[model samples]
Target: MSENILDIKDLRTSFFVEGNEIKAVDGVTFQVPKGKTLGIVGESGSGKSISALSVLQLIDDPGKIVGGSIRFKDEELTTAKTSRMRNIRGNEISMIFQEPMTSLNPVYTIGQQLREAYKIHQGLGKKEGTKRSIEMLELVGIPSPEKRVDQYPYELSGGMRQRVMIAMALACKPELLIADEPTTALDVTIQAQILELIKNLQEEIGMSVVMITHDLGVVAETCDYVAVMYCGKVVEFADVETLFENPRHPYTVGLLSSLPRHDIDQDELVPIKGNVPAPDEMPSGCRFAPRCPHASAICSELPELETQEDGNDVRCWIYTEQWDGEKGVKVYDNETTS
Candidate 1:
């Protein structure tokens, strides 16, 4: 068996609207090692969530997986039948969506929702399912699992509801878990608690995690590997320490510069200039060329994601030998203007 639990290569997912195609995830590739966390970080409209959705074959109408491969345990997921996907979805792989209230059915009690997973995956009856449901609720550290299981989603706090979502996703003890902005809606304390809970649970269950978030702090805290995405592609990929210490891609540098740092005194936060281009109006060359500080004539052509001497992958012209500009130009030091 391979060390990687999930491997995505050149994956493309697009949406057809008004006879035009929007490439939401354009030739994206990454790997998630077993019992480790991989953080996918980028701003909104960067295809972070779309890539995760494509893994479960959950793309709705007007959207489809156009090309590339999604391999889970050496099983090709893009061509997997509906029945096969159904068996894999909650039993071997699970996901916790951004919002808990919207994902959970309001009409059903939390117990009913949790029990359904056990019933479908393990063939457990109502009595046995309910018994396991309460145990799962307790495992996630819910205050009163016996009472909370019978209550509706609307009856619990946001943090509690999120815990219920985690419990539901883990009910089958999946080998892989995809957490999409799990702590986005919580307060600082609650967010910390939720992250800690996930880390503890991951250690307990020994599952690989794909953590999708825009927060760099979360990436630093939880991720072992990092993939910095921009627009619709992965611009940089490296281990968490290498990424923070020496980010190769200009977009990654811009993102790190924008973050507020208490360790070092700064005059102001350096925000990346300009808005993300519309999907239909994407640049023919490098997607970030319009906003990059080091963009040159060579940037008129898109650069391939190539490995550098340091063994990190970066999609930028500055690192290439054909770079027409000054040799060894410091992208991190270059100041971006509005």
Candidate 2:
């Protein structure tokens, strides 16, 4: 059997707002193995959320997938019609959004929502669905789930609500789980709890997870592999250890250097030189060249993201040209100016 559970190939998603085309996700490619976590980390507007939405075919309104393929369990989802897409949405690929409060139905009781999730996907009888709902609540670490299941969304704490969302997503035992900034809205303590719970659950069930976040600490803690995105493009990708220990791309290095982790001294946080470029007017050449220190004449021509030796990959001319291999050549390591 193939180890890869999800393969996204060169996906490009765009939206038309007032007759203007805004490409939100551009040429993102990555693979997630069964029972492992692949973290997509970048700042806001880097296209992390949009890429996850594209996988589920849920990008609404003016947004649409413009190109490339999304393969789940060897099935192509890129061009699948709405009717067929419905069969896969929550059944095969479940998603947990960043804001569980807004995502949950505030008007409905928690039991009603969870039972609907179970009934819709599993086609269980009312009593069976109710039973399963309680089990799900318990699974997500909600205490006294039997009682909590009957409570409304407003009655539960923020952490509990997020847990409910995860429970609903897990009700069908989906082969893959897509979590979009799952902890951004929660407090520090709750964030740790939610992340820990997700990791533990993935370990027990052997489900592939695509955890999307801007938090490098979260990626370092849970993800086995990671893709660093910037301005709708994946600038670097490699296993978690390799990415943190030896980031190859300038953008990736900038992101790692700026992380608010203790290993990186508080005074040593080197912020990226420029803001995330807007989608409408992206820079030519390397999308990051204006802010890249190692950028030279060659940087005026875009570099392709290609596989390096030992299964690592990067999209910077530094790796393509000058690295002798003892240490990665980081252009933005100190966030210098040319």
Write one digit per residue (lDDT tens) for candidate 2, span 1-338: 56789988899999999989888888888989889999998888889999998998989989999999988877889988888888888888899987788789988999999888878878988899999888777766778989998889999988789888988888877889999988776678767777777777787878889999878878888899999898888889899988877678878878877766533445566687877777666887788988876667777777788899969778877777643333554444332321
* Model 1 error, position 265 (Å): 6.7
Give the TM-score (vs. native) of candidate 2.
Answer: 0.88
Q: What's the lDDT for candidate 1?
A: 0.88
Model 2 regions lying over 4 Å from their true place: 119-132, 138-146, 157-159, 262-267, 322-338
TM-score of each: 0.91, 0.88
User: How far does residue 43 in candidate 2 sit from its true spot (Å)?
Assistant: 0.9
Question: Residue by residue across 1-338, what tens digits does model 1's lDDT show?
Answer: 88999999999999999999999999998999999999999889999999999999999989999999999988999999999998898889999998777888999999999889888877899999999999878766687889999999999998889889988887777899899998777776767776787788789989889999877788889999999888889999899988877788989988887865323445667889998999878998899999998899999999999988877799998988889976778876533321
Best by lDDT: 1
Residue 278's lDDT within candidate 2 is: 74
Clashes of 2: 0
TM-score of 1: 0.91
- Model 2 scores a C-alpha lDDT of 0.82
